[model samples]
Target: MAVRVLSIDAAGIDLAGVALSRLEASLRKQAGDPDACVADFFDLAAGSGAGGVPSALLFTRGHDGRPLLSIAKALRQLA
Candidate 1:
């Protein structure tokens, strides 16, 4: 089995959206999923300082233990 992971910097919640935007685009292109989520691709998420905001958002799980927030929704929350 393989595990994929992603790391976000401590760029603050405002700019975190920027990184998530770029991540959304890349995930969309690579995964071909209309609703791409960080939890789909990353088994583990880490952050530094204020990056914890997005790290928390990205880690939110549904009943099935999958990520609940779409990149758009996460973006909205960040906004």
Candidate 2:
């Protein structure tokens, strides 16, 4: 079995429409209050649970003959 996870943070981008506002809100929330940001996006090939290593992942796509990419990650909490 395998599990895939994603964590988003201050890095990446700000784009048009809902994406921009959504990302902005997320950044603000993560900033305003927290010891660590647990909020993230994930896609699991197996079961879901709170066990995994935090790291970064990059996604790429093509738009109107142009290529676009973005960075995302699962940030580790440090005390």
Candidate 3:
């Protein structure tokens, strides 16, 4: 048996109408509260020893009350 995983370079792709809509929908869902603060997530601490690490981290929330990206919805938008 064999397995394969598909991945996309999020930065390499351009987002437009449908994609933007999808992203907004995902952001809302992840935040739970629509008013939750949202910001671009990144992993600055990641070691430079490796390549291909995602340039950005998945949307996440802060303890102060924020929402992260709804990964599932983001993937769906790509599809």
Error of 2 at 51 (Å): 38
Instruction: Point out where model 1 deviates above 4 Å.
Output: none
TM-score of each: 0.79, 0.22, 0.26
- Top candidate on TM-score is 1
Model 2 residue 14 distance off true place after TM-score fit, in angstroms: 13
lDDT of each: 0.79, 0.30, 0.37
- What's the ranking of the predictions by lDDT, best on top? 1, 3, 2
In model 2, the Cα lDDT at residue 63 comes to: 68
Off by over 4 Å in 3: 1-15, 35-79
How would you encode candidate 3's per-residue C-alpha lDDT over 1-79 as one tens digit per residue?
4432223333433333234346546766786755422233222212122212221223345485443434444335445
Clashes of each: 0, 0, 1
Task: Report RMSD for candidate 3.
Answer: 10.3
RMSD of each: 1.8, 14.8, 10.3
TM-score for model 1?
Answer: 0.79
Q: After superposition, how far is residue 70 of candidate 3 from its true place, in Å?
A: 17
Candidate 1 global CA lDDT score: 0.79
Best-performing candidate as measured by lDDT: 1
